[model samples]
Target: MDGLYEQFRIALHQVWQRRWLAMAVAWCVAFAGWVAIALLPNSYEAKAKLFVAFDNMVPTAAAASQNPQNDIMRLKQTLTSNENLTRVVRRTDLNKLVTSDAALGGVVAGLRQRIAVVAQPDSLFEITATSSFAGLSNAENARTSAAIVQQLVELVTSGQLAGDPQRTQQSLTFLDEELRRREQQLQEAEQRRMEFEQRYMGMLPGTGTVADRMAAARTELAQLEQTIVAARSAVNAMRGQLAATPATVPIPGAENAYAGTASGQLAGLEVQLSQYLGRGFTEQHPDVISLRSQIARLGPQAAQERSRGSAAGNGIPNPSHVSLRAMMSEREAQLAAAESRRAQLQADLAQLGQRDSAQPGAAAEQARLTRDYDVLRQQYDRLLADREQLRLRSDMQTQASAMVVRVVEAPRAPSGPTSPNRPLFLTIVLVLAIGAGIAAAFLKGQLQTTFPTANRLASVTGLPVLGAVGEVVGRAERTRRRQRLVWLVGSGGALAASYAALMAAEMLQRGPVA
Candidate 1:
């Protein structure tokens, strides 16, 4: 510890002996540092405060429950977007100053680097822009910063700016069109479902398992059996009535009456021909031609039958037999139709039984169809609900009843440059210059092998020094030393003068301080 202290003392003494050289080195370093600082452009910063209030005229439960932090973040991103930056550039002199496309891009990129957005307490946000250009005047720097902030404010306030209210409206319109298209799709789906139900009828997979379908089919079959029984009873009753009536009823002019009706038959044929013509069938159609020929043949036959009836002088046979035959024919047709319906019901019942026997296959198919129908139905319903919610949101937006951005503090021009902090920079440069000077002095001392102190001499020679010699200066030597001091002083003054001139030139170029 004592040795370290002694070494430190010796180093201090050596530094003191060459103090002028140290001072000169320090001065040169400090001058260079100050000149570099002067050459640096001034940076001016402008700041604005924004109080983001989530104000809405008609606040919904959803909107009110939203996180304001997320909205604030989104707002920050919007302000920093390239589109907003381009607007800021256009509003200032940057647009004209930038020449080519690449230069403009570089300018925009540099501007983005100078901007900062910070969220403070109490829902307030701060936007700061720093403007600095090579050889820029203090007033120009301040003006640029102010312009950038002003353009940012305009972008935030104007809804027509890109990715703001215009985007919101476009999204709403797109959703509206999508909703309409979905509605059309839903209507078409419903139509298809109704048609399918009509075509399949009872066979449709409706609200039950296969067992339920089987039970329904059995019930339908029972009902059809009862209808068949009723129809058979009616047929039997009609047969009994025919059986009770005589097969032939005596009528004085029955035969002649039947023969005389030929004229009415010919009139019926003419009516049939007219009906075919009205049905859009041409006369060349097989059915139309056949009807015409039948009418032509019937006309002559009717005339002959009428003449024979007139010559015989007999009234037409009793019309009761004709009436009985027509009644029997109608009953037989009804019985046949009823039997056919019963057979169809029986066939449907058999199909249901077969499907029940093949339970796995039938059940899988039924499940698949049911699942598909249910999925589509659910999707349709969900889309309907979403459309309703979208409509409410779109209405809210259209009415300007949603959260909005409002500026609490407007931007103003800065009074002075915020950067290059000349005092602090100069202080740091002075410290570093002193340190460098000390290092250079120690380095110069180390290069010489001669002992700088008595302790170093003793340590190297292993001998105790009792005395030290002091050189006495001659007259000529003294004059030479004095002349050398004058030369150094003159050189220092010249350096000082040059530094001052450089400072003056820089100050003149920067213009008067604002």
Candidate 2:
């Protein structure tokens, strides 16, 4: 370790001996760095700010229906699109200085990167722009910034308003179509109701609609009345026929029940005996015996009466027994005819009642259809109202839902160029050059590994140092040494080269002012 330390010290001393050369290289490199920075053109940066705010209208159900958030999102996308940027480029005439098309692309890209379009926290947007112009004035920078932000605002605003006409037109068209359809539906419904009324006219009572159960009942009553009328007519006609017909016409060979026969004489004798008994005659009295004898004598008469006649004239006519029998037969015939007619009328009435029972279902369906049409019509009307309100809003005098940009901090002409920070550049150059110079000197010394110190030579070769000697020279010896070009020439040339490099570095640092 000691040996290595001694070797390093010797190496450092050798580098010091050539210190001029190291200093020269460092100074040259640094000066070159300064000159490079000086020759490059200076650039200026300009920035501007834009403040944005969305519509602050009070939110109503109407506003919610419009979906204003969608509008805001669309505004964001429109502001960022290439078309808007291109418009900004044209308005700013950025192409004048940015000559080449490809170069212009790069400039535009750079502009986009530098510029910012950020929404402020809980507010609208903040737009910013930065540009580099070699020697632009304060006014010019301000104008550029203002122009860019303003153009961006216009681009976004125009885009926002772009779809208005088409949207409005489409709305109008839709409303018109809906109105027409609704009108048609209402008319058709009315026509259908009228047709239904006409078809069943008087079949349904008041309201002429079977929608009312009472009306249906009344209609049934009307049909029943017609049936009753027919029934009554048939009964009257049967009664008239029974009244006109003869009552006692014989039923031909069944004549034992007829008048003027021995059965009549015998029926008379029995009536007399019943009367005498009612007068309190005794069963064995003479009057009773005479009645009995008369009854006996009429026995043949009774048989004759049974065969062909009815008893007559014994103070009471025999009640026309044949006529009564014939009248009973006629009455039975009349009853049969009336009953058949009543059955037919009853059948017709049942059919009418069945029809009346089904009426309510049909009427209810029609009512449901009517209600649906009415509701749809109302919806269409409300939509129309909303559209009209929007149209009015567009026409009305009011502030636009847009932000105003203000220049909070105006740009100023810089006192010194922002670029080419001289001191910083110089420091960077000095540090790098010093590092390179030190490294080169150390590396050269290591690679050469010259035996500059007596100790180094002694240690490496194990040689003994006999004595350290300093040269003792006379004038002649010095002159002879100088005459030998090898040593003297090399030393002189090295010093001259070092001095020349220093002068050149100084000259390069301070060029012509212009």
Candidate 3:
């Protein structure tokens, strides 16, 4: 410890002997460092806070599970995107300053680097922008910083207000068009279903499984058979009533020599004679001659009796017999219709019974068509539902009921520059300059190849040093030493003047420290 102290003392004495050289080195290093620090541009940062709110107005289950932080992060990315940066540049004075398009890209990149985004809890965020300090005035730097931050806020807010709404409206229009297209498709599908049903008719698998369809067909067939039986019974009853009634009535002034005194007997014979005549019997033939003689004989007697105004009228037809004949005709027509219906029912039942025996290929094709129709129907329904949801979402967005962003704290002009701490820079420069000067002195001493102290000399020579010799001051040597001193002083003065001039020029061109 004593030896280290002694060595330190000796080195201090050597440094003191060359104090002028040490001072020159220190001054040079310090001035250079000071110039470098002074030339560094100052940077000013401005910050503002923003608050985002998630409205979740659409009332969807997914909305509850949605992460607001993800939205915030996405917004941050959008704010810093190249396109947004370009827009910001165009809106600000950057456009005028950067004339070349190629150079503008670099400027935008640098601007991006100067921006800082900090996400906070509760959907709060902070946006910061930094720029090189402008003019000498602190107000100018503050104004620049504030302007940048304000522009950023405007960009974000304007994008939210204008872009988001327009995008939502566009989406709504697209959805509306899609819904129309889907409706058209649904109509076409419905038409296809109708055609298919018409083509297959009772063969379709309607409302139930194959077994159920067969059961329904069988039940309908049985009902039709019962209806046919009832129709036949009604026809038979009408026929019996018609058989008991007379076919015709006696005509007035007709002869009665052909049969009994009953006018109906004479009417019946006349009807038979007419039938024979209608069968192509000539009037001169025996049958026709006999019928004609009979009619001529009965005509007078019947007319005389009719003129007597007898209580029993024989020329008029029986109303009951006429009614029974009409009923019989109606029953026959009904029986025909019922038989037709029964035949159709039988055919349908046969088809249902043979469904399993039908061609496998046809059955598979029918199933495929039915499945396709069902799928299309389901798809149409789903699209209809989605269209409604999209419409609701669009309305909510239009009303600004969804996610919202607002400036929580407006940006203000800074009171001072945030970067290029003048005092701190000067302190670092001083320390570095001192260190450089000390190193230079040691290097100069080493280049001399001579012992700087007695301790060093003793260690090198392995000898004991009794004393140190002092150089004799000759006249010429004294003059040379004086000249060297003057030169050193002049050089140091010139260096100081140069440094001061450079600093003054820099202050004039760039701004003074804010």
Candidate 2 lDDT over residue span 342-448, tens digit each: 56545544554576576646566556656766776687678778767766544331333443334444434333334555556656776776776666677777787
Judged by lDDT against the true structure, how good is candidate 3?
0.68
lDDT of 3 by residue, 1-514 (tens): 9988987876676665665777778788878888777777767788999988877655666343345776576677767877777877777555655769887898789889988889998889999988772333445555667777898888777654234455556777886777788778778776766675554455633454344565666676677688878988888877755644555454566434324553445456576776776688887899878877876787677666556744144356668788888888887887788778667767775775565466435445556667776877787788777766666545554463566679999998765567766656666766676667667776676666767667688899999999988779999999998898887678657755655565565445344433
**Lowest-sum lDDT 10-residue window in model 3:** 254-263
Which ranges in model 3 have alpha carbons more than 4 Å from their true place? 58-60, 81-87, 100-106, 133-141, 156-400, 403-406, 452-456, 464-514
User: In candidate 3, residue 469 scores what lDDT?
Assistant: 86
TM-score of each: 0.52, 0.38, 0.47
* Model with the higher TM-score, candidate 1 or 2: 1
What lDDT score belongs to each candidate, Candidate 1 first?
0.69, 0.57, 0.68
On lDDT, the candidate that comes out on top is 1
Model 3 steric clash pairs: 254-298, 254-299, 255-298, 255-299, 256-298
